[model samples]
Target: MRGLSWQIGLRYSMDRSGNQLVSFLSRLSMLGLILGVALLVVVLSVMNGFDQEMRSRILSLVPHITFQPWQQDRGDWQTLKAEVEQHPSVTAAAPFLQGNVMLIKGNAVEPSLLLGIDAAAERKVSRVGDFVDLGLLEGNREGLVLGDALAKKLGVEVGENISLGIPQSSDSNDVRFAKLPVLATVATGTELDQQLLLSSLETAARLLPSGQTLSLRVSIDDVFNAPRVAWELASVHGQDYIIRDWSQQFGNMYHAIQMSRKLVVIMLLAVVAVAIFNVVSTLVMVVNDKSADIAILRSQGASQGDILRIFLVYGAVIAGVGALAGGVLGVLLALGIGDIVAAIENALDMKLLQSDVYPINYLPSALRWGDIASVCGTAYVMSLVATLYPAWRASRMPPAEALRHG
Candidate 1:
């Protein structure tokens, strides 16, 4: 069997014109495979990276589940949190006070979303403490943790004091304003970095004349299970509160990434298709150049099927070689591009990962095995299909007439 295979390979290689045509076709195939694989790897990696970054920045700070009452602006958060915790999917639940408030520091003023959370409870649900440095609550109900951008805008440092004022009551003429001490600085490269504030729930409750908590934050066992868990929680809680998922708030960006990924796939497929066509053309040329040999084989009682198989195997070799080369090259390029770009950016003193300009920094690449397999498989299949017609045409040649003419 091994000797037979070697004989077939030797015959295939000895056909000079056939080998040249196949080599040319193989080069074109390699070009297509290289581009397609490289693009697929790079794009999917980028999308995966972006998706991960978004999840980390958004989910790390925001709860997987948020409970906001439908009819009432405020609710008994402690009771609701306790009730929600009974569910197996529910991991930790915390009370939160959320409202729009203004911060005044060193003659500069900025508007922000005031999130009042119990320090201990927040630790259970989110990573606020890790992001926040230089904060000491110590039961100081009037302390605040400010976003890094907001702090810079207000020209306030970690130890600096800032004035936080709630809107005065409409009916009463008292000019009392809620002022707080700035305790910490948080710098997460997100929208929250510019317009989010952290304070004690007690302080928030006191600031509001109504003295009510608006929402309760819940963290689930798995983040991807947020919607399912939220649905179950809502089913249990009844119509009093509405469930909100991170997707609902940020679906546009996710959808955009998905659309871009699809477009990339289409583009890469076009390149592969072009490569297949090149292979088909190369096979046709090979069949023409090997017509004399084909005639001899036909006279030797070789079946048409055998002739087709030989040519098919020849095309397969070319396609397989190119696919292998492309796959290896693509992976190497994808894995190293991020580090290469980062290094260049650093040497040039240019911020490739700009926090102030963009939401996140650092080029991210995440290659999936599925994408690689799909690209390589598609190339091989296309190349084989493309070989059929030309090989079949060569196989059907008249052996007697060709031998007499030659």
Candidate 2:
């Protein structure tokens, strides 16, 4: 009987001799589901890619944790660095001098975060060496490395001298000026490109007052664990230092990404649900059109349960085929969306993402099987549930009335 029900259901599903409108609606429902699922997959994959870029590009260069003196007594930076390196979560540690300064070239002036670093030790703590020309800073205390965007804004180039306006004291209006030749430029494809100035520790010390203490910057294996590790390190030193973590600096951006991802999922899932529920309308039309056939089957000893099962099977076949096909199409699109967008950008001769505004100016994608499974499963289940009402209506129809109406 089960086999017989399957055969009948499949035959009805495949039959195109019936009303043309019914067949068209069925196909349209399938098409909508395919489009909705494919779009969801692609968008989520792109969001995942952005998350990856944020972690890799921004977090890699920004210190995961930093420690600066809160008291007047400057502690031994080498001892602190060595102690930080001994932590299990800590990967590398380096000493740095950070201060804000204004860059002046001719008539152009721009504000920048001046970071003084040891070229050799900085490489161990961050990927700054990969983006910076380390050779230019080596043994060149009077040289400076500007972020590409800052350099462009100042109309300065490599080998051009730029004046640094450093504040003499935090409380006073006094400003000390010094000139240094631009050694190189760093292009990090992030906002850092607009505001960073790199120089050797000796050069930065010369620009500032005599008694500024060096701070420790530490990188860890797990970025998310930075806050906990930072506090633990602070506790060991009896709270004499100020502890800062990456989250305090960039937490808002990370939260924004997560919030955007959740909103996108909710909106896209609603679209998919609407597409799947269109099957309800399609099945209702099928039930009305097949009343005469349904009456004949009932008169031939087909039980109400059998009638219900037939329509359920029919709906299942439609939902199953549509969901499977959509899943396959979505997976394919998600895997290649990056290249597709890149090709489109090239052909159009325009940028979708600007380096000055956005982090990493390119579309990226990272397909996850978990997301694929969730989307397809939700679609299929919604589609299957949508068939219940029409199937029940078909089962409850009286054979005598149906035949009389036929």
Candidate 3:
């Protein structure tokens, strides 16, 4: 009986060779399902890729947590660092000093951030030296390394003297100046690249009284737990210590990415829902067109259950073909998205994202089988639901009434 029902369902689905609207609607149903699933796969993978780039490329430059003394007196940084490193979440810790200084070249001058770091220790927490133009991060003691943007603005390069204007005393309004040779430049590809200058702690100490201010910057195993880890740092360091995390500076951007992901998913789900429900109209029309065939079958000893099974088989086959094609195509698109985006960018002669403004210079994509499974499951379920009402209607038709009415 099931084999007979399948034969009839397959024939009905394929018998739309003459009618234009039936053929058109059938094609439209498949097209909608294909496009909907493909879109979800491509878009969500891009979002996941962006989230990954933000964490690995951008966050690698900043400390996840910082421990500073509220009072100006410096704590025993070596001991404190040792203690902080014991935490399972903590990856590396380094001491740093930050000060505002002005860089003056031959004719241009700019305000810059003087970041004092211990090269050996800083290497553990930051990727500053990894992406330099020349072999610049050799850390010539008492020398300076400027960010690419900062160096360009000042019209200086390696082996140039840039005068640093530093305040002489906190007691009075005296300003002292020191001439430092630019050693190397770094490009972080971030806004931080505009005004950042890396100097050894020796240089910063020589320029400014060092013992008064030094902070411990720590990196963590997980970016999301930075704030909680920071709180733990504070609690362990006692009330006199102050704590800050990268989330305090970059949390809003991370939050915006997450919110956009959710919003995009919700909006696309609506689109897929519309496409899936379009199956209802197509199936209903099929039922109407085949009512006579259904009557003939009923009169020939086929039960209502048989009639119902026939249409159900028809609907399932339609959904399965559409979904299978969509799933395959979507995964293919997701896998090739990076190359696809690059081609589009080259053809348009414009970039989708600017590295300095956005976290990455290009769109990224990662296809996870789990996400594909979720999309396929949802599409299949929606298509099945859409088939139910029309299938049920076809089963309830009275054979004599349908034949007489026709």
Decide which is better by TM-score, 1 or 3: 3
In order of TM-score, best first, we have 2, 3, 1
lDDT of 2 by residue, 1-406 (tens): 6677778899988888889999999889888888888888888888988898889888998999988888636678898888888899999888888888888989998887788888888887788788976766667468899889889999999898999999887899999999999999998877788887989888877887668799888899999898899888878964667888999988888888889999998999899888877888899989988999889999998888888999998999888888788888888988888788889999999978876776667777888889888888888888888898999999999999888876
Tens-digit per-residue lDDT, 273-380, candidate 3: 888777888888888878888899998888888988999888887788777788898889888988998899999999776655776567778777898889888888
Give residue 66's error in model 2 in angstroms: 0.3
> What's the CA RMSD for each of the models?
4.3, 2.3, 3.1
Q: What are the runs in model 3 whose C-alpha is more than 4 Å off?
A: 102-111, 133-135, 139-143, 146-196, 207-212, 404-406
Give lDDT for model 2. 0.86
All candidates: TM-score? 0.79, 0.92, 0.87
- The best-first sequence of candidates by lDDT reads 2, 3, 1
Q: What is the TM-score (0 to 1) of candidate 2?
A: 0.92
The local lDDT score (0 to 100) that residue 158 gets in candidate 3 is: 84
**Candidate No. with top TM-score:** 2
Candidate 1: worst 10 consecutive residues by lDDT? 1-10
For candidate 1, write residues 210-320 as lDDT tens digits. Answer: 745468888887887887887888787758887886667666766776788788778877877887787778777777767777678777767777677777677777677
RMSD of 1: 4.3
